[model samples]
Target: MSLDVVVVGAGAMGAATAWQAAKLGADVTLLDRGQVCGGTSAHGVGLVTRLLWEPPDIGLVAHSLDRFRELDETAGASFDYHDTGSLLIVGPEHEDEVQKVFRTWRAQAIDVRPVSPGDVAEIPGCADLELAKAEHAFFTEADGWCVTMDAVRAMVDEARSHGANVRPNTPVDRVRDGLVRLADGDELEAEAVVVAAGVRSRQLIEDGWRPPIDAFRAQAAVLGHEGNRSGPIVHDTPNRTYWRPEGSGQVMIGDGTDLSSHEPGLEPSVDEAFAHRVAERLRDRWPAADPIHEVRSWADLEAATPDARPLVGRVPDRERVYLCTGGNGFGFMRSPALGEGLAQRIVQKGSPVPLHGCEPSRFEEGYGTGFPMQEGFALD
Candidate 1:
């Protein structure tokens, strides 16, 4: 059956879009290259922090957070939805910049406040930590992590039950004339098509319209910290190593700067040297954490536009074709808002929130130059 809307890419945003669209009484079909939970969605750090620069974006992410709370209650399953909050440790040189972020959050009335070095130590997991040499730090009451894969699966299942057709292992080739052609040469026609294909959405449009959404590789080590007392997600700004408890007795570690680049569909290699460097950094920062044992890793191309924001809104010169790629380093946190904004455009013929800053047409109109290449890295 022909669908009213055909959504490409079934990651977090795609799944959320399909589920919400179906809930709004639209006949939707969601297509993913692999399984729904694969790709960037599953690989993300699952930080659900509402700290954002753009006010409109905060609304959408906050919406998703609200849904997450509701879904957790309804499903009676914990996606590890921890409100343990987030601590952004500041360096001496970067303290002012961090304050700028805090002031911005305050102006926006986000639930954020400054924490003294002493006060910061009182928070769960941060207690008794050495902060004498530290600069400044702030804590947000609105940040934590979630089990991304399970949430994506639950949303996909909910959409399917609402008569939305979702096909895993069905990667779409491209869209032509408002029709989406899958890898198997199968065609599905619809009045509107939403390109929520993550980093891959850039290549779906014609050549000149493509943005420089660079694809980069990033590897993380899920360390087993035998006696982690830290209650919140812990991050050290200077070293750029972030550690957070994964429940029970295990904690995960990833270097904020240990990201690499890759071509489309090419598997990523775990950098042993890079991993060792990260381990060394973590050891110095935490001091009491257990040694790294085994590691499990996967890779996918992550796309980011030049401006460090996502390319959302309609495709240029295409009737009813909307592009929702380019979440850059902020994809997972921004998925809820992106999905809602796209749905508003599709269902109501106009998005209440202005997407001018993130519209794909801006790239086409030369508002921002393109960094078109085989692949690039995210800037988060």
Candidate 2:
């Protein structure tokens, strides 16, 4: 069947886009070089939350959380969607900024409140942390985490149920105009094409057409504890680290540092040094927990934009060619809203969500010279 839309990339963003388009009655085809959700999406730490410093991101993430709830209710299985809440810990230096953000969040009607050291100690697995030394912390009961692959699977299955075609291991060499040329020398024409191929999206477009996206190597590892060590997702600003519960007794930690840009298609490998650093941070933060055992570690390429936001909307000067890349490592958390918004814009020519700041053409104005990788949330 001739597709009304062809979505390149089957990660969380692409899967959600295909599902939204199909639900809106569009004949959608989602393509991926590997199995669905097997890219960076599989390597995500799965920390989903709406506690963002950026005002524009707040709405998108809030909407995404609501969508996650909706999907969980109808998808017949939990995506391990846990509303365990989240904490953003800040030392004395950042206390004022954290307080200001807390006020803003409260004013926005978000369920966020200031927390003191005593309050922090009450949260599970945080009793022995050195957070008491920090000046302040903000806690949001509505913020939480989920299993990325579980959500991806539900999205893909729901998209397929809506009659969307899902093609796995079908790599695309390039996209010209509204046509997708596969690696196998086949071409498929569509009413519209969405490049959601993460870092690889840069390679699919014409030369000299920079998408303002860069890829970075991100590393993370899991640590197993002796007993169940449940707790809110922690974003320790002082250490530039974040950790969240993996299972009943395990926790997953990742480097929140801004890493250098990396080449696309590089084989994912774990860095022992990075893992060791995360382990050190975990030990410092949760001293009460039993000696940690490294269960696993992995590294993958994550995409980022200069503005720390995604490039959504139509590609400049290209008819029916759209882009939904450059997630800045928060792709999974933002995918639901991004996908729905992009689907609406493509199908109805307008979206309910305000996507002006995320337009692809924003880069044409030359926003900044060097990459702004350090601008967004460290754990993104």
Candidate 3:
């Protein structure tokens, strides 16, 4: 008997897709190059927020957050979900955009509020911020952060419970529409094949056909701070960085984003310069921040598309193939929702209305010309 769907890449997106697809009664097989949740999904700081508005993904974000909370409440499942909400700080220049976002959230019945920079210190685990030079700030206690790997594992485990076959350490050398060639030279056929292998999805996508996705190196650090690390997640737009409270006395900061394609296998460790620079930046608020107190830091490749939005759904010019990559940096934020939507589409369970601007067919016009990496989370 043939499988209904074969999902490549066992990361969060892949696992979520499998979970939904299998739950809907599709025969599913999810394959991964390494262990489940081992790739880019494992390295994320897992910032969950409705604060991101540029790409206009509020519905998806809301769904993902609900799913995260649901998983946390599940039996034997610990996603380490933290419901501390989130804050977005910007300079005077970005205030207009932030104001629009605030209004939109308010209209949507979100409990967000305009806050002065000094108020940020009041958040339980937040240190005094260097917002003396900042202009606009907003906060909503509805968003939160989570242990991404744990969330991913829970999703995968749920998928397994729903009868999805998961195979780890199984690398696929090639992927064709409705079929995949394993690294061991075996070929498996399915009715639908989804390539969610992060940046590498471009390579496994039917060989010569370029899918308009690129890879870039992003580094993050885990730092030991003096106070409790349970503050609302912060997005410092001016600094192009974001941070969240990480365990008991630690914080995680990210955004050493190298906006260029990272050559595979030439992975570089986090730069000492990045640690030093971010540490000095952190001291403006925390004061005792230091690179020497770094618990762990690492770098990994992140995916991006020309338009910054991800290509989710069936690939253009192909019937049996689909795509779920190139989310810029916000893929993990919407993983659960994305997976559920894609799974429903594949299983023919939802409305036929597409993701609008996010459909994969939009790239069919250019069809492979190299494009610069663009982060999906950006203001107009």
Candidate 4:
């Protein structure tokens, strides 16, 4: 049977998309190459916050956060959301940039607050705080993270109950004549196709249509702690490192700069040097915490665009095909709002968010007819 919508990849974004589409009365089917939520969606730090510095992204982030708040009541499962708050410490080098963000957020009336070193140091696990030497910091008491795997599972379950079919270990080879062809000779016919295949999206395009997505391998370390710090998400912008309380006895520490994308088909692996470097940074920041008990890590490539924003709207060349990939590293955080917005556009025939700046056509229009590439290199 031809499905109303066949979503590729069952990560957070794909799962959320399928759930929304199915919930809205469309027949949906979700396909994935491996276990559900095994991709970057599972590996994400789950920072679900709308405290964005960019004005354009503020509404979308806010929408995502709001949706997350309603998930348990609507979707029948709690995604393990924790509103422990978050902090962004600014260094001398980033003072100007930080101030600019503050000014813009304040102008827009966001709940962003500028703070001093002493203010940040008072938070738990931040006793030996470096704020006194740091430049500035920002806090959003309303921010937090969702349990990544649980969120995906809940969405999938809800979508299935709503008549959507989600299949794992079903690797899609390509799309031909408006149907998704599998390697084992199965075909999925659909009225529309939405590609939310994380980094693997780089390879699933048509013969001539490729997105300028670069795969960056990112890794994070899970530190075990005894007590949950009521302290907000502890972050040091200069070190590109952040620590957030996880469950009862653990904290998740990740370095933002531990990113280095590789070519397509490159199996994700942990960068020992980078991981160790980040661990050292974390240790230095929080000397009170015990040593990392079990360090679990994975590498996933992010679809990065030249301008650092995602190519979120419809594909320019193909009318039936839509492009929802290239979320960079913020896909999970942006998925709640972004997925719902995409669904609204697909169902209503126009974007709820402004498409003038985010359209995939902009790349072709600005680049003069070349396929989207990273440094002009093709995905294959």
TM-score of each: 0.88, 0.94, 0.93, 0.88
User: Could you give candidate 3's per-residue lDDT for residues 255-275 as a string of tens digits?
Assistant: 645677776456656777887
Reference-based TM-score, model 1: 0.88
lDDT of each: 0.68, 0.81, 0.79, 0.69
Candidate 2 residues lying further than 4 Å off, grouped into runs, are 1-3, 365-372
Best by lDDT: 2
> What digit string (tens of lDDT, one per residue) describes model 4 on residues 258-337?
34557757777777675567666765666655464645666676667766576666766676666677676777777766
Model 2 agreement with the true structure over 159-260: per-residue lDDT tens digits: 999999999999999998889999999999999999999999878986445687777777888888767867789888777777888887898887747467
Selected candidate, larger lDDT, 3 vs 4: 3
Residue 202, candidate 1: alpha-carbon lDDT = 60
Q: Write the per-residue lDDT of candidate 1 for residues 140-215, one digit (tens) a residue.
A: 7667777778778877877887799988899788776578888788888988888888767766655445555666
Worst 10 residues of 4 by lDDT: 371-380
Report clash pairs, candidate 1.
124-231, 125-230, 125-231, 214-376, 215-376, 216-376, 217-260, 310-326
Candidate 3 structure, TM-score to reference? 0.93
Alpha carbon deviation, residue 333, candidate 2 (Å): 0.7
